[model samples]
Target: MKSTLKKLLPFAVVGVISGATTVGVQQYFGHTSNNEDGSYFTTSKNVSFAGMNTSAVGDDFVAAAKTTVPAVVTIKNYQTKTSSRASEQDMFDFFFGDPTGRNQRQRQQQAPDNMPSGLGSGVIISPDGYIISNNHVVAGASKLEVVLSNKKSYIATLVGTDPNTDISLLKIEEKGLPYLNFANSDNLEVGQWVLAVGNPLGLNSTVTAGIISAKGRGIGILGGQGKAANPIESFIQTDAAINPGNSGGALVNVNGDLIGINSAISSTNGYYQGYGFAVPANLARKIVEDIKKFGIVQRGFLGVSSLDLSDDRQVAAYNAEKKTNLKVGSGIYVTSVTDDSGAQNAGIRTGDIITKIDNIAITDFADLSMSVGSKRPGDKVVVTYLRNGKENTSTVTLKDQKGGTSTRSKADLSVTEKIGSDFDPLSERIKTDYGLNSGVVAKNVTEGSEIAKIGIVDGYIVLEINGKPVNSQKDIERILDKYQGNVQVKFVDDYGRIYTKGFKMP
Candidate 1:
């Protein structure tokens, strides 16, 4: 009886050990499933799952891209052909070289029946369909189409364009569209992560990421008529791989906030070669707001031309001329002031080296420009400058591009004091030499006249009425008398150069 009991105990112990080993293996492999009471276990060979630990970098970037890409859009523009003269074709041929020198034959042949087409990128700025893009993208375009990531295309209307800043605003008819909010570009620090979203090379909704390479970099690319000199070129440089078609796209922070508009690139091959430039969203916002309010950007200018402090010789000469003991290592040296610019009005002289604006240190011309541009016309700002080794502060009211105190009045002679037109007519020799048939010569300018107030001097010859040739004083008087309100006059100086000035007649 004892041997039988021992044999049963050994068998029972072996069965219990084998069952425990099976349960351990099933638990480690996650193949065992249990009920709430822990009394039942089940396993299915066909059901399988696996997972791995991932990093937050991938998830955060992916989420940012998803949020930003939808607000980035592809802008397609079409400029209508107004003439079939083949002037553009001839110009193209002159540089590109005609395969067959039959330039005459090509010119005689009918020009392409279609309009010129171009593509770029834009950022949706408002949910009600206001989009912002570079002016060059939609300038002179007869038709503009904006396409979103959701495959919805909307025709956009050009609200306004500021060529000085290369910013243009457009409005789409659709409402409640996805848009991106702007970040304070002034707060962006070097080395912050940024993402560039655009239609690079027509590749729609492409995003490239990199850190901010620099801030306040001036590339000297933008310039044209009535366009102020490239004053505000404090671009935020990045390595975000902005390509040709990426112009007007958004350069966003990692949190999906728009900080800048991707503008130009330092490239030799016309493609991304690492260096890229963007207009700060702060400046862009000001320009966009100005263009939206007025048909053009109403920018405030100090009206003083300045040279970089890097030009030591010029700095020294300026110091000597102005009799100032300013150390020539920093700050902008004012070279000349326009006759009636804000600086001139504020008694800011040519020799004054602007050292600070609103307590912010002015390191160079770019700094001054950015500071001034940040404010609208009529906004008063404090300018601290060094003159004759003495620091002086002035509270100067900003003026618009047309040399006016504010942008409220659009009258041609709003800011100018109109001088009475009591002047001797231009002589025949002076007319022949100046290449004008006839016109009235500005002999005496009164102090209260708009011309005198804005710095137009006596002795300037009126050359054209509207744009037509004015051969006599009768012609000038006739044009002015006929146009009772505001009129634009094209006049030639004694040296024969022509300039256009607008004035309101009494």
Candidate 2:
């Protein structure tokens, strides 16, 4: 019986092996076994042992790159030469040489007629051809060109620029281009992952990844000769390896949403040295929208300068000034409120400790500036402060640089005159040569007129009246006569530019 069982086992094993081999071959050849009723069984022959293991990471980065790279663009700027100055070498040769030879050299040394060229990067902010970049990129540029990811280049026009923030807006003629949507920078965490996308070192559409190193960082990086002076320096610092060409690029989050504009880097060698900074997207969006609507940023001012309470002496002074339960180092101490400022108009006095703006608690000047900067000129905010050892709150209506209320009504210049004796008309040669019809040439200004109050200086030319062309003083008078009430006068200078200003007719 044992010998018979062993022989049967061998036969069974052979039958099982042969059946397995036949099944494998059938599956490979796309043949599935079916029941006698002709119902087929489904099977797959190429099942991966490590199934879906590489899809999450390998596919995610490729997908993000494909989505974001297309929105990044390269910006090229050109400046036209107005007048040429002699080169230093030529001037030295002429000044130190013999009189006859110097005159001949001066005659031979003529300035080049070509303009200087510059390059930078810009990010498309909207689908309708709006772009945001650094002001330094397109400053004094005569021509601006933007190159899209598809290698298509288009001429761009300068929409507006804010030197205080180092931000500039540009518009391309083509519409419906790929763009990035802004994410709320206020929601960003300190260690959140981010990507810096730009034309770094002229390598177009380059991307580098890092985490947000810090927030609300005040590094005096943008302060230098010939740079736009910025009073506020709160910046979002990252370790994304930004370089020269990364200015005006997009600093996006992991979800491919833009959270900031890559603006500057901290380096001595003029290259990436790990520390890069970006202007928060919230600020960028506000400035861009304001520029689009108002042609300039309507900055809100608190009208008071304050000292941070973090300083021991300042904290002691504030504590001594007001006997309260407040800690030694708590909030920003108001040092002085300028007369006629918004704060003064709102009855904010000196020695008041600002504890909160709106609902966010303020710890220092940066917090106050960031909060105020986030608001428009007319927006009113509740300021919580400590006065005389007692907590108080007040609703302060913000004001623009010009001392005005929280409305868009035409500024009152009723007490002013149209053209003072100080008004100097443009010369006939300048008017005829520049193809002028009517305009106002500014001369000496008074101390308290509307023009002087708004900082319009001598030599400024009024170029248009009520949106109509005004090339000379005669045109301004005619338009003022035609529209006797409030009129919008556009001003231009010796250079061909325009500024829209409002004034009431006398």
Candidate 3:
């Protein structure tokens, strides 16, 4: 019995030694294999990591790519150029670069019938060939063509466009198309996997994957750029490698749901630099629906010009000047309130700090813009604000730019409404001073209008439309009565620079 006990003790000692050696080796190497949560610990810094090895969790993007790629399509914009408008082409090239990217001067030096085209991308949103794309992508296009993933091409008709949101809706004559369903963008959280499907750089049906880096990002790419009047810019930021042609493409999640549309990129050289911005799916979907129903965006106006409180420098400056202890990142500081507007009627005055809309916190202009911009005129929103260090709430009814609470359909709009601008015949003295053959003065260029999106201002002088001299509003109505598709306008800016621009007829 003593000999058996001695032999068992030796085996126990051997087992203990082996266990100790294994533990010591593991500690020294800092390797942990039992971490089933896709995490690991290494000896390099005794640090733990997660989501570094995505293969462990099975990131099979094949299903997502298959579902998204078919819904994405390539868009081609064709424009006919005339030799007489070479200088005008230069202006267009300066504002919007030639999509073909060949030598503009060389192309301009070609025949008067030169047909230069641009390339972009689009996404089908309905099974009946209803598509959505960036307004800039199809803007000024004489002809738009959509190419499906299977190489089928079809001429597309422009349904409508909202420049404030940079969203455009187009319809092709086809049935049973692959489309993407809109997901609730408000549910999108940062760091979630997403895929960008588009025709980037003319690459057909290109797909790239990344994560949602941010939400409700306002980067001044939209109305903040001073081009779009009342720009709605609550963008969803992602690192999804969006490039030039990716504009108007689909930004979808792994479940193949559309959350946003790739719109702009943050880059120093006009290329992807790991930062991309998209129009949030919610805002975009609203714009498209409005356009489809009303033939225009039924945009609601909050009726106040304010400064973003999130801008530290601006907030500091305001607080110092106003002698108010305003907190940074609290909300927007109202600088001025529009007269006869809903905000003024609701007792919202200058110096009021708007904090929220409809119970949604307004951390910055982006939040406020999204909350209110999504609603149509006559929509009521509960506005929360701070005045004199006291919190207050008001249910405010939104109004249109004309200070009206009623909605207007396309048929209800007149010729001037369709043109989005009122005009007065140019005075003889003004025309003589400018040495113009025929001219008219543009007035009240409506915000978010097709002409406004083309950079036309309220005080610009209109010389021609469709190459015919426009001397009065009646002349414009006459010419546009028979005009179709792209309408060319020759105008002179305040500085007397003659520029010809094109915009699609609404």
Best by lDDT: 3
Cα lDDT of model 2 by residue, 1-506, tens digit? 00001111111100000001111233422332234443323468865425546456435556656667888887875543431111111212222333343222122222223322445678898888999997666654546788898899898988877655667899998778888999999999998878888876456778877789998764543332113333445678899867656778888887788898887666433345678888889888988887787665677878787877756765667667866334557687787998887788888998899999998888766677778877777788889999988998888888876666543322322122333213456678767866776666765443223453233445667666577865445555555553567767567643455667664553
Q: How accurate locally, in lDDT, is each candidate?
A: 0.66, 0.63, 0.75
Q: State the local distance difference test value for candidate 1.
A: 0.66
Task: Supply the global lDDT for candidate 2.
Answer: 0.63
Q: What's the TM for model 3?
A: 0.76
Full ranking by lDDT: 3, 1, 2
Model 3: pairs clashing at backbone N, Cα or C within 3 Å: none
Q: Which runs in model 2 stand beyond 4 Å of their true positions?
A: 1-60, 82-116, 221-230, 311-330, 388-390, 406-506
Predicted candidate 1 versus true structure: per-residue lDDT over 1-506, tens digit per residue: 00001111111101000001111332422432234443323357844223522345446567779889999888876544432222223222322345554432123222233423456789999898889988656643557788898889888887866555667789998878889998999899998878999876556899888889999876555531112244467889999878656888989987899999987776433345678888899999888777666655667777778877855776788678978655657788787988877788889997788889999888876688789877877888889998988999988888876667767523333212122444456677876766666666664443223343222345677666567766555566555553567667676643455777665664
lDDT of 1 at 462: 66
Deviation in Å, model 2, residue 71 alpha carbon: 1.3
